[model samples]
Target: MTQNRRWRRVLIALFVVVIAFTGYHAVRTVSDAIYWNAHRDEPIERWMTIGYVAHSYHVPPHVLHQALNLPPMPDRRPLGRIARESGRSMNQIEAKLKYAIVHARPPYPAPGPPPRPFMPSPSSSSPAK
Candidate 1:
């Protein structure tokens, strides 16, 4: 009977912890979403991540990373943090990236004619004497 009671207590404790953790995350996500939605009309902050800026402006993530000279990483950190770590002024980086977006260029020039595949000579195809 004691063992059963202890198991029941452990299960209850686990359930409570799970509920608390889930509830905290749910509330945080909703609040953060609301805050960003309200700030949509404002200029993006330096503390905003590159991904956020790119998404807001309809820019491709990879293109933005290339423009900013940033390496591909799992998590996109804020541009402010990036500027500080790279010892560059935020304005400089922002200017270059914004200009790149405005003056976006194609990665390649106009396509040229496809090369023709080489074919074996007719003489050689005669079972090579």
Candidate 2:
């Protein structure tokens, strides 16, 4: 009976820990979603990387690279580093990113009518009477 009680206590503790862990993450996820949604249109900054800017501003990374005349790749470097390496000012980089964001096309084309379902044509053979 004592062993069973100890096992029960252990299971209860484990269950509590699991619940706490899940609750913490759930709260964090909701808070982050709210924060990002609120700041979705925030301006890009020099400290941000290409991927970060792309995600924050809803602009494609390729558009940003094209605007900045950089090779198409996953550039992990921050904008400040990129500007410094390319001998350009931060303002120039910011301007190019802004332009690209302003002119960036929608990632997907406009939805069109649903495709018609395929139907086999009626056979030329007559049905037996």
Best by TM-score: 2
Model 2 lDDT per residue over 16-74, tens place: 99999999999999999998888676777878998888888887899999999999999
Error of 2 at 46 (Å): 1.3
lDDT (Cα, tens digit) per residue for candidate 1, span 18-98: 999999999999999998776542465688787787667666767767777777653378888888887888897788677
| Candidate 2, poorest ten consecutive residues by summed lDDT | 119-128
Task: Report the lDDT of model 1 for residue 33.
Answer: 97
Model 2 bad stretches (over 4 Å):
106-129
Measured with C-alpha atoms, the lDDT of residue 38 in candidate 2 is: 83
Q: Once superposed on the true structure, which residue ranges of model 1 sit more than 4 Å away at CA?
A: 1-42, 104-129
Clashes of each: 0, 0
Cα lDDT computed for each candidate against the true fold:
0.77, 0.89
Give the worst 10-residue stretch by lDDT in candidate 1. Answer: 36-45
